[model samples]
Target: MVGCPLTWQRVSINETIAPEDVAFIIPGKTTLAEIVARLGAPDEITSPDGRITYTPFGLRMITRTPQVITASYPGAVARYRFLDFKRFRANFTWGLKFIQPVPGIPDDFVFESGGIGTDEFLVVLDSNWIVRQHAFAKHADASRYRPWPFDLEPPDDNQVVSF
Candidate 1:
């Protein structure tokens, strides 16, 4: 029996900065004002040693994990976090109804398959507020809505599971 219909969904938080947009940044040379003009104001600015404090807040559901870094005097950081999900299933139990979900009634619904992909970009500034260092991580296929949520590529020999 066809359990239920399947729907694909996507959700993203904040605009993901493109690689090209930041390519022009030259560490030790790019000034803070130039960086801001090129990429707009950073989401968050902070000084580890009492000079950094800023972050963007929205779409509380999306999760982002960032490493704690303590920068030098009067530094700053720019952070961008984005995530996308796909394939949503609605489980419902029907004793009489066919489509409409009945409240208070537990349904035999299983979200068979879904996927989540996330990306983050971080820019760190030095005491001079110049481009001290930066890093960016993204999934090559973060946008592709593959039917299967799990990894389909050939298994990695190094990534072995233990009992």
Candidate 2:
């Protein structure tokens, strides 16, 4: 039954922005103006304290107001959490045949495997809008053997999983 149609199905997911592009954004060097220019406007912007969040596809960036000051990349600081299985299953597949070797999927379905994970980029600015500190947080549900009938237990929270 393995690799059989009944046991597997094709799935596809599109990222609004590429992970490499996000990596290009330097913590102490990248500026808000440059981010807007490179990535365009964010999905949401919050004022008062000046918090800007961009949600492009699956990537999330939370930063303070624009500033010329050098920003800091605190590295991964937050505790990792497992993503929801339902969402992960919806976006993932279990076979190499389902994957297409190309820059982008032309078809409606974007064949992908593994659970949906959250990668967060955080930036904190000083009162003058200078980048003070920053951090990246990521969490993904563990990939497991899921039968076609979907009879697999959800990821256990007790386990310390990493991707």
* Tens-digit lDDT string for candidate 2 (47-112): 324333334433444466664423343321211122333222222333434675544544233332
The sequence of per-residue lDDT tens digits that candidate 1 reaches over residues 1-163 is 3444555566666577888978988889887789778777765565645444334332334347664756656666666666666555544343324655767755564444655667767777777778888888776374555554456688777987789
RMSD of each: 7.5, 13.9
Q: Scored by CA lDDT, what does every candidate get?
A: 0.64, 0.41
lDDT of 1 at 16: 70
Measured on C-alpha atoms, candidate 1 has an lDDT of 0.64
TM-scores of all predicted structures: 0.58, 0.35
Q: Best candidate, lDDT-wise?
A: 1
Clashing residue pairs in all predictions, respectively, total 8, 5
